[model samples]
Target: MPSTPEVNFFQEYWIDAWQRSILTLDVLRERGNAYVERSARTAPHVLSFAFEVVRDGRTLPRPVNYALVRIVPPQGTAIDSAKPPFVVVDPRAGHGPGIGGMKQESEVGVAVAAGHACYFIGFLSQPVPGQTIEDVCAAEAAFIEEVAGRHREAQGKPVIVANCQAGWQIMMMAAIRPDIVGPILLAGSPLSYWAGVRGRNPMRYLGGMLGGTWLTALAGDMGNGTFDGANLVANFESLNPANTYWEKPYQLYSKVDTEASRFLDFETWWGHPVLLNAGEMQWIADNLFVGNKLTSGEIRTSSGVRVDLRNIRSPIIVLCSWGDNITPPQQALGWITDLYGHEDEIVANGQTIVYTLHQTIGHLGIFVSGKIASREHAEFASCMEMIDLVPPGLYEAVIEEVNEGTERPDLVHGKYLMTLEARTLDNIRALGVNSDEDNQRFATVARVSEINQGLYRTIVQPAVQASASDRSAEMLREFHPNRLRFASFSDQNPLMGPVKGLAEQVRANRQPVSPDNPLLSLERAASAWISTCWEGYRQVRDAATEAIFLGTYGSPLLQSMVGLGTHHAPTERRVARDLIREADEAQLRIQLQQRFEVGGLPQAVLRALVYVRMVQRSVDERSFAMLQAIRDMQPLNDRMSLPELKACLKEQFLLLRLDEERAVRAIPRLLPESEAARRAGFEALLEMLGARGALPDEAARRLARVESLFGMNAQPAKVAHA
Candidate 1:
C-alpha cells in the first residue's frame, strides 16, 4: 500500500474534484431533468389528485372551485361505533388537500386505523371567482352538515383535524359553529399570529423586509385577481439557501441511483404551486400574519361579529415541533399566552387545551414523516377520549417509554408511551424567555404592514389593477422565477426526453459510493467544511438583521402605530348574575367529594392515591365503560333518553357494592327529588361519565335503556308501574 499521507492526500483530491463537478451547471441540468421525469412517473402512486367540486348555491368564481375527497375505510373492516369521525382540513397555502390523506401513512390514515371515519377538505387547482374566505367557511359548514346527516345512522360527532393554514380556518369555523364539531386537533399550526421570539424565527420578518403585503397585492393585481402559489413555494425554499441549493441536490446525487424517484416526487409537489384570490391572500397577510388579531379577540368576520377564542369550547389539541422554524412551539403555544395570561383563567373559561412539542422535526415532517404520523398522531388519536376526560386546564404532553424488566430504554419500532403533565403557563415560559420586547417587535411589524398596505391600495393598486388582465396573470404564473426552473425542463419540453432516457439507462447499471470509496470519504469532509462556514454566515446574518429591524421599527413612533402605547381598554359588559343564578337555581355545586366518587373512587382515598402514586392522573375510559356495563346487571331494566340515562348510570356507578351494606351507603346520593335538582345532580353524573369516558356497545345499550326511561314524553303510568 501507499504511505498513509499519500493515500489521505489522494482521497481529499478526488473529493474536491467530485464536489466541483457536482456543483457545475451541466450536472444540475441532467439532475433536474432526471428529477422531473421520475416525478412524472411516481406522482400518480403517491397523490390522488381526483376530487369532487363542492358548490353550495352560490355562483362561485372558477378559481375557488374545490374538490372534496373521501378517505375510504379498509375493506372487510368493522368500524367501532364509539370512535368519532375525523375530517382533516389541509392547508390551501399552496399544495392541495391530498396531503392530509395522501397515503396509508398520513394523518387521515392514522385516524382511519383508529376506526375514525376519515374525510378530507381539499380544493381544486382553480378557486371559484369572488370566493372570499367567508364563502369557504360557509362551504365547510355545509360539508359538516352533510357528513353529520350521513353519520346520523351511527351516533358520533366529527372530530376536525386542521393542518397548518387549515388550523386557523377550522378554528374560525368552530368558534362560529361549535355545535357541528366535537374535539379539534390543531397540528403544526400557528394561531396566535404575532407570536414568535427574535433571532429564532426569521420567517416572521419576511413581510416587513418585503415592504409588507403590497408586493402580494401588486402580484395579485398582475395575476388579474389570483395570487400564484409558486411565490409561496419560493418563500419556503428561500428559508435555507444551502438546503435549497446544494444539500438537497447532493443528497440525491450521492444516492442518485436510488433516490432519484423519491426526490422527484417531493419536488413535483414542491414545484407544482397553487393559486388564491387577491382578497383572500391580502386578508391573510393583514389579519392573520401581521395583525395577529385572532388570538387577542380582535378578529372579526365580514359581517362584523367578533371572533372570540373563548367561544371555542371544544377540546383543542395543539401539536407543534420545536425544530419547525416556520411555526415554532412559541407561535403554536403563544395563543394560550395571549388569551389567558394565566392557567386559572383557562380553567375558569372552561377551556381544555393540550399541546405537544417535538424536539426535532421540520414543518413538513409533522405531517409527512411516517415516524411522527404513526407514533405521535396515532397516540393522540388513541388517547383523544382521555384528553377529553382531562378537566378543563392547560397541560403539556409528556411521552415516555414503558420499560419492562430491562436496563435499556425500550423501543417499539422507535416509539414510546407519553405521560402528559398538567402544567402552568410559567412552565411553558421556562422553556424560553418570553419577553415583551419580542411582542413589541411583532406589534411594530403589524403596524408597519397596515401603513404599507394602505399606501399600496391608495397609490399603486389602481394602476396595477387597471393594467392587469387574465392573460398577463397566466403569463406571470408560468414565468414566475420559481416556476421557470421546473417549466423550462419538465417533460413538456421536447428537448429533454432523449436525455432523460439516456440518464435512466446510465442509472440502471450505475454503482454507488460506499464507506470504502475514496470519493465518499472526501465528499463527507467537504460537506462538513461547507456546513461550518454556512453556520457562521447564518449567525452573522441574523445578528445584522435583528439590529437593523430594531433600529428602524423599534422607535417609539412606530410602536404606537402598532397600538402598543395604548392598552386595550376592557369592554364594558355586566356579568349576567342571572346566568349564575340560573346555574345555582339549576342546582350546580362545587362538590369535591362527589367529583372524586364520580371519577371512580372515594374523595379522601383518591386524593391519597394521587399523592402516593405520583405517576399520572388516572383518567381512563375502561372504568367508565365498566360503570356503563353495570346497566346490564340483573333487574334495573328501564329505557330512557341517552343524556338522562347516562346521567343515571353515573349516579348508580359508585353504588356498586361488594355487599348490600356497601351499596346502601351510596343509595341516597343516587336519588333526589325536585326535578331541577334531580337534573343538576344528573348533570354531575354525566360529567363523571364524560370524565370516565367511552363505553362498550352492550354497556352503551344498557345505558340506552336508562336513557329511554327518562326520555321525553314518558308515560306517568310507567313511572307509577316502576
Candidate 2:
C-alpha cells in the first residue's frame, strides 16, 4: 500500500500527526452535529439518568419554562419512598440545564444510588413570554411544594441540591417558603458577589470595567426583549482564554481517539445555549451581580415580601472550592458575616450553616467532577439526615476518606465519612473578605449601574426596541460567535460534509504513533508552549482590568457623585437588626433556659451530643450513628421524624448555649435513672469522643466531667448496640 511503502519511524510520526489533525477536526464536527441534534429534541437535557415528568412550570399559576422530573433509579438501585426525596435545581447561568446530572456519577446519581427519591428541576430552551425572575422563583417554590406533597409519608422534607445560579434562586424560594424545602446544599453559589481578594478574583471587577449593567440591558434590547445565554457563556470562556481557546481543543486533538466521546458529551451541553427574558436577566444583573443586593436584603418579591437570606429556615450547607475562582469560599460564605456580627446571631435565628471547602477543584468540578461526587457529595448524602438534626449554628463540614484509623468504618456508606465541626464567624472571616473600602468600590459600581440603566431606559432602550424586530433578533442570535463557531463546523457547512467520510476512512487505516515518539513529544511541547503564552496574556489582561476598575471606581469624585457622602459603604447595606427579631431572640433564650432538662433517651442523647460538640475535641458522626440506633430501638409511633429530631436537637443546643452548667447538671435528670439504660447511651457516645492516642488535658477533663455527669466511670466501654 502507499502507506506501507513509507513505513519508517519519521514517516509513522508524520502519518500519525496528520491523522490526529483530521480526527480532531472530525470530533469538532461531531460535536457540532450533536449540538444540532440536541437542540432538535423535545426535551434536550443531558442527564444520563432517565426521568419522568412530575409537573411543568408552564402550567403553574405563574407560567415559566421549568419542569420538575423524577429520576428513575438506575438498575440495581432501590429507592426508599419513606426517606425524604432529593430535589436538584439546575443552574440557568448560560448553558442548558442538567450540569448537576450530566454524568452517571453526579449529584442526582449519588442521591438515586443512595436510595433517595430524586427529582430534577430542568427548563426549556426558551423562557415563557413575560416571565421575570420573581416568576421563576415562585414556580420553583410551587415545584418544591409539589415534591413535598408527593412525599407526605417521608420522615423529612425534600433535600434541595441547588447548583450555581439555581443556588441563589432556590435560596430565595426557601427564604419565602422554608416549610416545603428541607436542608439546602448550595454548590458553587455566589451569594456575596462583591466578596473577593484584590489581585486574585478579577471577575468581580467586570461590572466596573463594563461601566455597569447598561450593556446587559442593551443585549436584551438587541435580542427583542430576550437575552441570549451565549453572552454569559462567552464571559465564562473569557476568564481563561488559554483553556477555552487552546487547551480544551488541543486536548481533543492530542487524544482524539479516547477523548472524543467525553469532549462531545460535555460540548453537547455547553454548546447548546438557552434564552432568558430581558426582565429576568436585568433583575439578576441588577440585584445579584453588579448590585450585590441578595444578601443585603434589598431584593424583595413582587408582592412586597422581603426575600431575606436570614429568613431561610432550612439548614444551609454551602459547598465551594478554593480553586473555584467563579464562586470561591468567600462569596459562598461571606453572607454569614454580612448577616450576623457573631455566631450567636445564627443560633438566635435558628439557622444551621455548614460549609465545605475543597482544596483544588474548579467551579465545574464542584458538580461535574466524578471524584468530587464520590467523596464530598457522597458524604453529604450519607450525612444529610444528620445535617437536618444538627443544632442551629455555623459549622464546617469535614469529609475524610475512610482510612485505617477511621472509627466505625462499617457505618460509612461509601469511601468517605463526613463530620460537622462547630465554627465561629471569625473562622469565616479568616478566609479573606472585602474590607470597608472594597465594599464601597462595589457599592459605587451598583450606584453607577443604576444610573446607567436608568439612562439607557430613558434615552436608548426605546430607540433600540423600535429598530429591533423579531426576525432581526433571531438572525443576530443565530450568528452569535459562540453559536456560529460550532454551527459553522457541522454538516450544514458544505466544506464539513466530506470530513465525516474522510474521518471514517482514516479510522479504518489508523496509525497512532507510540507514546514515547520524539516527534510526538515535540508536538506536545509546542502545544504546551502555546498554552503558557495564552495564560500569560490572560494574566496581563486581568491585571489591566483590575487596575482600570480599582482606579475608576475608587475615585472619591465617583463616591460623592454616587451619594455616598462619607465615601463609606452605607451601614444600612448590611442587614439591619430587626427589633422584632431581637425581641423574639430574647424570648427564645428565656425559652431555652426553661427547657434545661428535656424528656426521654432521645432528648438526653441530643443534649450529650451538643455538650461534647461544645468541647470540640473529636465527637463525630459515630455519635450521630448511635443516635440513629437509639431511634431504631424506639417504638414505631414513638420514633421521631426529622422535624421532631431537629426541634429536639435545637432545643437541647440552645439550652446548652443559654446555660451550660444547668444543662449539664440536669443531664442525669433527662436520662433514665435505670443504670443499664444510661450506661449504654454513655458508652455509645463516649466511644466516638475517646482519643486514639493520648488525649489532651482539656479534652480529657471534659470527658471525665461528662462521664461523671452520666454516672459512669472514666473507662469508656466498647460501643454497645442500642
Candidate 3:
C-alpha cells in the first residue's frame, strides 16, 4: 500500500509540523536553562569573547556595579598594542552587557581583527544599592582613566564605543573630562527625547499618555527599591506585536531545523533580566526620557557642575537607523539640531560630529546584526585615525560596499569603503523633524509628568512603600511575563521534562517536508495573514495613542493647568552659549591667521588637500589614504604622528574657515624654499588627487588652482586610472 504523491506530501507536512512543535519546545527549554544558569552567576553577560577582569567600578571610590574587562583576542590573532585601544561600554537598559561583543562579527571582534587592543564595560546582575546615574557616569569615567593608563604606549587614547544608553553616559563623561577619551562612537543612542513624526514613533508618546513617569516611580516602589529590568524589555517587545507575539514562535515551528540555535542564542540574552535601583530608574525617567535634558544642558552633577555636551572635545560618531522605532533617526540626530542652531556653531565650538544613518535595521540590530558588524563597524575601525584627524565640523559618515568593479579598490579596506563628507544641520532636519506643535505637546507632557509625579508622591507613595516587601518584590519579579515565559518551560518544570528527549529522537530521524508541499504553502500563507493582521492592529494602536496624546497635551486648558499655555513656543531645548568660549575662539582665530606661514612640505600638502576638499563636493577615503601613503614615504623623522597631524589639520581647517581666500593666498608661504622640496610636494599632491579614477571637471579645476599656488606645470593630475 504505497502512498500517492498527494498523500505523501500531506503526510510529510503533518509529520514535520508535529516534530517542530516538540523541537521548538525543546529550544525553549534550552533558553530557559540558559536563563536559569545565568541567574546563578555573579556577573552574567552575553559577550562572545573570552575576557579577563581588569578593574571593577564597585571597588572605586564611588561604587557601582560596572566593571572593565579586556577582551582576549581569539587564538592566533595578534593585537597591536601601539594602536588606539577600543573600549565598548554596554547599555544596561535591560539585558546584561557584552552585546557589542556578542559574536565574532561584532564591534569587539572588528577591533581585535584590526589589531587594536579591546576592552568592554559590563555591569552585574544587580545595581549597587542607592546607586544613582551620576554614580554610574562617574564610575565609567574612572574606568576610562584606568583603560587609558594601561595603554600608555597606544597611539591615541582609547576610542570609546558607546552603545545605546551608554552613548549619553559616555558623552557626559567626555564633557566633564574631555582629555581622557579619544573618539566616541554613539551606536543607536538617543539624545533628543521628544523628536518624532506624528502617527509614528509612538514610544515617545507613552509618557504623555500615561500622565508621565509616575508609573516608573510606582514600578520602582513596587520592586521594594529594586526595579526589574524585565519591564523595560517588555516595552521593547511591545513595539512589534507581530514579531513578539506570533512570528517569533511561528518561525521556530516553520524553520526549526535552522533557526533553533539562533532563537535560543537570542532568547538567552533577551530573557536574562537584571535589576536597577528605584532612584536610578527615576533619574533616567526624569532627566533623559521625559525631561529631554541631556543635550539641553539641564543636567548637573552631584557636585553642582553643569554637564554641557559642547564641552566634549572628542570626536562624536553617531550611528542610527531609520527603521529603529525605539531610537529613530530623529532621536539619534535631533540632539545636534537642538544644541546647535547653525553648522558654523558646531565648527566654532571646535567639535567634530559624524553621523551615519542606515536605511533599515532595528534598534538592537545596530549592534547585534552580523552585517552591521562586518560593514559599518568594520569601516569605522579601518578609518578610526582618519576620522580622528578630520577637522572640527559636522559631517556625515558614508560607507559604501566595495563592489567587484569598485574604483580604487586598493585604497579600501575589507568589504567597505568609508568616507566623511561635510554636512549641515539642515541635513539632520531633513531626516524628519517634529513641528512646533509637536514640541509644544512634548513640553506639556513633561509638565504633566511633573504634576503627576508630585501627586503620586503625596498620595500613592505611602501605600505602595508600606505594602511592598523584599520577599514580595522578589516573587513579583519572578512572575514577570518575560521571566515566567522562560521559567514555565524550563527544564525545572515537570511539564516540559519530556521535550528534550522527544526533540532528540526527532532530530535523529528528521523528515523536513519539501518547500513545494501544498499544505506547507497554505501554512505559510496563514502565517503571513496572521502577521498582516497583527501589523494592522499595531498601526491602529499607535495612531490612537498619538491622537489621544496630542488631543490631551495640545489642549489649551490642560496646557494651562500644566503651565505650558499658548504663550510658550515649541522649539527643541538648546544649550546656552558661553560668551567666554566665544571670546577664546575669536582669539584663537587670530592666532591661526598669524601661523599661515608655518611648516614645510607636509604643511603645504595638507593645505592643498583641504583645498581639494573645499572645491570638490563628493569625496571618499581615496584621497585621505593617499595622504598617509605620501607621508609614509618621507623621512622617518619628518613624518608627523597622528596626534600632531590632527593638530595641524584642525589648525588649517579653522584657518580656512575663517577666511578661505586669505588662507589659499598664504599656502605659498608654507611651501619649501628648495626646488626639489617644492617639486616633491607638488608631485605628492598630484598623486593624492589622481588616486580616485579620472578627475572630474570640478576636481581638475580645483587641482589647477593648487598647481598655480605650487608653481608646477608638470604632468596633468587629470591622468585617469581604471
RMSD of every prediction: 9.7, 2.9, 1.8
What digit string (tens of lDDT, one per residue) describes model 3 on residues 156-223? 98899989989988898888888899999999999998998877799998888788999999999999
For residues 217-292, what per-residue lDDT tens digits would candidate 2 score against the true structure?
9999999999999999999898989999999988988899899998988898899999999889988988889988
Candidate 1 lDDT, tens digit per residue, 539-650?
7776677677767666666676567553533221111122443454234224323442343222222222122112333333333333244333424454233333433333
Tell me the TM-score of model 3.
Answer: 0.97
Highest TM-score model number:
3
On lDDT, the candidate that comes out on top is 3
Checking candidate 2 for backbone clashes, the offending pairs are none
Off by over 4 Å in 3: 1-7, 713-722
RMSD of 2: 2.9
Separately for all candidates shown, the number of backbone clashes (residues 3 or more apart, or on different chains) is 23, 0, 0
> What shift in Å separates residue 533 of candidate 2 from its native position after superposition?
0.8
**Global lDDT of each model?**
0.62, 0.84, 0.87
Residue runs of model 2 more than 4 Å from their true location after superposition: 1-7, 565-573, 617-619, 671-722
Of the pair 1 and 2, which is ahead by lDDT?
A: 2
TM-score of 1: 0.76
